[model samples]
Target: MEDELEDRVLHQTYLSFMKIVTRLTSSAPHDTPVSYLWKMVRLYFLRSEVAVITLGIILFIMYLQTIEQWSRTLLSRLSQAMSPISSVQRMKFMEGSEADKQSWELKGSLSAAYAIKGRRMHMEDRFIINENINNTGISLFAIFDGHGGEFAANYAKDHLIQNLYNKIVEIDAFKEGKIISTPTKDNAEDKPQEPESNTSVERKISFKKSVSTADDTSKKEVTDPELLAQLSKARPIITREVRPTKPIKNVPVPLSSYLDKGKINFGKLLTDEVLAADRLLVEAAKRSMNVAGTTALLAIMEGNHLIVANVGDSRGVMCDSRGNAIPVSFDHKPQQVREQKRIEAAGGYIAFNGVWRVAGILATSRAMGDYPLKDKKFVIADPDILTFNLNDHKPMFLVLASDGLWDTFSNEEAVKFIKERLDEPDYGAKSLTLQAYYRGSVDNITVLVINFLDNKVASSATQ
Candidate 1:
């Protein structure tokens, strides 16, 4: 009975399979692709479970590959949005230096941010920190804010320190009678001179000519401390290089004497070197076919003296022990009376577009390059120099930043902001820069913070 039942079931199954095959053949006049598909489907069902697992693994891998491609595309787009081809933000840099003779130390950090215009450009700002220049204990720190192009700023960063050092070498040579003539030409007539008026908006600068640029349009500002924290991690502008040194020569007097004698005329030396750099820039621009401009703000600390030289709008502010903000350098705007006189005297007019600009073009009255304007004899390369005796007023730190930072934070406000973060010297400049960006500054931003509070000269006032 069992055998008969099994035979009947097998016969019924065979009949059902034949009916399916017959229907498939009758539905198509000729063998169609669908018939092959149906045969494959039937084969698939007849296959073992291992085949099904294999197919599932293949599908999973394909899905993963698709997801990976999508992620790469997303990352590529994000990177492009962060900066333009020419202006990618560089990593932050931090270094430390101590004065040779004074009981003070300097800590410096630099970082760059993209401009609001959103082009692929480099950080047009550059800086230098020589811990022990020629091991003289004289530390040099500077920031160059470039506009129109990065050439000027980069050039200044690479050459400015060496130029200043060369000037000092000449001074030493002159003192020792190794060279009869000064390293710089005694071309007082050719150099710019300060007006006798002490009330000039900024100090009377030397070697200036007329020029013009547009000022920034005011915008609603915001603040971003978080952004600043992130910027602090960027790589430095340039790797620290061995500072070029002038070979030690016979000295008629101690090195200190040469630096301090007759106020050492160090201020003049600085001015001369600055003008020399500008000339070099002009010549370089002529060759490159790219005329660019940059603002320079420099601080030189030798023993008890802190000297500052600035061109254009970048600023250097010193915070005293009492937390008072001291303007070591001033912004050179065409709208200022002294700057205006100089600009007009050079045959440049200050036109007002969104803000006061030089000849309806540049906003700054002084810059290192701008050869086209320089050719017109309207824009000039000159700097304002100020000297402070750190012995008298105990200092806490120094802030050197481009106009992007000054556009948002005031002298006092910035000093106060830094004062609150005295514990983290490196973060001082980073925080200020972030604040400027959050405040909606459209220009590229760069900041250098040098903390004096942590030096051996910690003042009771700030403490």
Candidate 2:
């Protein structure tokens, strides 16, 4: 009886072990050979509760890590995409119409337009139109094409005019054989002009603003008459009839030196102001931790002089009435001999990814900001200045545009294109920008079209 009871207990224990194996194997997947292997694993682990718990913890940790990495990647991409959109919203007013169809006239001579955004979210370009500067028949128009960011371009548009105006004021005072006044922040606006003749009646110079709307929107001409009138109202008049009781101190410079038409070195003056602007922009960018730069192409039309200044690849072209295309500014590129030499001297290398670029990053050797490359001095902000006496040539109009328009269109081609649509300055610029876009230009485009034929002084130079 004792042997039979011992045998019965052993049989019951074996039955309990078999029942656990059957339950675990029943739940195991068996759809393929791999599933058969899974079944074997389930059987082995079923015998030990600790082994199963260990595997469950390992899988849970892996799943959490995968979720965390995926979340991070998604957020990073989303932030990059949305950041440009917010920037776009902040600059809607500055943007040109869809395809840059909108046109506004500056003074009576220049007609300008901004184009549609290319691949960029924002235009990444800014332009300026200040007519009748400093009681002089001078008009200032500029285009700033930005890269990496728009801060540099916008900053230039806002500040370059004032800086240049101050410089002009100082130079004019020097040319008049007068004592240079202490350069004050607001001197340009307050400085009085010397009398051109001995007339007792002071001549008041004023700019008139006029706006005429046409049936066709493209034909509308917009002028800031109020601004011009205000400038006239602010003109300072000094009584030259009653000489000062105190003897006046005059500059010792020869009268002939001041009388000579070519005495002023405008090119040097322009270069200095452009570099100063770059320094200011670089410092501002550092404070904000923003890395950005811009290509500047500006034109100042004063009397018979047309002064063009450039820092990067944007161009200024003057089309003569004889249909000749005169290049006012040349593109600044990394591969150019002068630029390459400068880059090498500054310990920077030019490499090609799509096109030749400075340090395999920036394409232009000269620009406004690009603070990362500023220390190396490879990418500079100094401008190439060109002075043209508009009277020397039969000037018809001036075309200033970012690289986007020039890359696909040659200088001669652009001149012909504009000449065909010369009747409509706004439409001409817009069409040219669109042409470049359709021709596969992958960058932002901005164009300024100034008609010298409209101004009576310049009309004599026209075809």
Candidate 3:
């Protein structure tokens, strides 16, 4: 019976061991840790969800970085592109218009405009130069517009006013040589008289003296009556017979024909000199091709004189204290009828757009550069200079601006707005620029406002 029990126990233990083996085999295929880890890795990889999630995160980060890099690059490029924006500086003075007549006080403002975008590429625009030399009431103001590029405008801006100043000084020097002379009575009475003393001469002298005395008495009677009557009338009508029967002969000189025949080569030397100067500057500037250009309008107040110079379509408008607008500068464009006619007369043709265009090349009637169109005796770049006399009755303010500002506002509108702002103590060019932007002026806008007041000291004290 004991042996039977041991066998039965051993059988039961064997059955339990089999059941444990079955359970382990169902739960896990392999007993090794490596095999289980390999199974888990295969299942995870097969699902694909974690790998896709990781890849999506990496791509999103890359995209965000790319966007950020692009934004920075674009902003940098835009800023670089606008590197040539112009700057303005101004100076105000305390002086009146006249010296001896100092009833009204004088005040003036001067402004300068400079742009440096493409330093190599010159832009031609308007500029102002004001120089108050001592208290001699000598001042100069000028405007320079560059066409075909900024080089010519800059050259003119630097030199034109100086030349004008020199010319004025030269004129003053020439006027110092006029002298007047007055006649003296002592010099007119120095004369000699003859005396007769011979016997034959004595008889003749007695007769001559009697005749002389009678003639003198008659002359005195005639002179006294005529002088008294002339003085009483206070007006005299003198008539005299004058000879005028000669006809002037006309002689035609064949100077032009002589020049054509090479008899006179004066123009050649002049042309060479001009060409040499022109070439030197062009080569120095590294600008053989006339690719740079600008337009300008400037008004300067020197004492009581208003000088206006224009090179392009930019303009200057003057307004009375009552806000009446007056154009001080003429627009120099080919579209103007008078300018078109002038260009055609100068052996040039106007383009179809009604502008003084050269072979459809330039829009302005006159400009500083455009080497291709510049000819020795035909195409010239002389700007129109005008002058006006400023007086008390015409107390005015001036508006100088770029095309951008003019495009959005009319002369009357600009004057009105400026007049309203003039009362502000700290008003400046920046405020005007902001107003232009607010008015939807998309292009770059610049403005200069000059106020001329009667009471200089009182005006400043009040401010």
Index of the highest-lDDT prediction: 2
Worst 10 residues of 2 by lDDT: 209-218
Candidates sorted on TM-score, descending: 2, 1, 3
By lDDT, the candidates rank as: 2, 1, 3
- Model 3 global lDDT (CA atoms, 0 to 1): 0.44
Alpha-carbon deviation at 212 in model 1, angstroms: 28
lDDT of 1 at 434: 56
| Residues 126-240, model 1: lDDT tens digits | 5655533443345567777777656677667655666565445445544555445422433222233222232212221221111111111012111123222322322131111
Q: Which portions of model 2 show Cα errors greater than 4 Å?
A: 1-108, 173-180, 184-264, 425-427, 454-463
**Decoy 3 TM-score against native:** 0.46
Worst 10 residues of 3 by lDDT: 204-213
Our tally of clashes for model 3 stands at 14
Stronger candidate by lDDT (1 vs 2): 2
| RMSD in order of candidates | 20.0, 19.3, 30.6
In model 2, pairs of residues that clash are: 209-225
Candidate 2 lDDT score relative to the true structure: 0.66
Best by TM-score: 2
What local lDDT score does residue 77 receive in model 2, on the 0 to 100 scale? 65
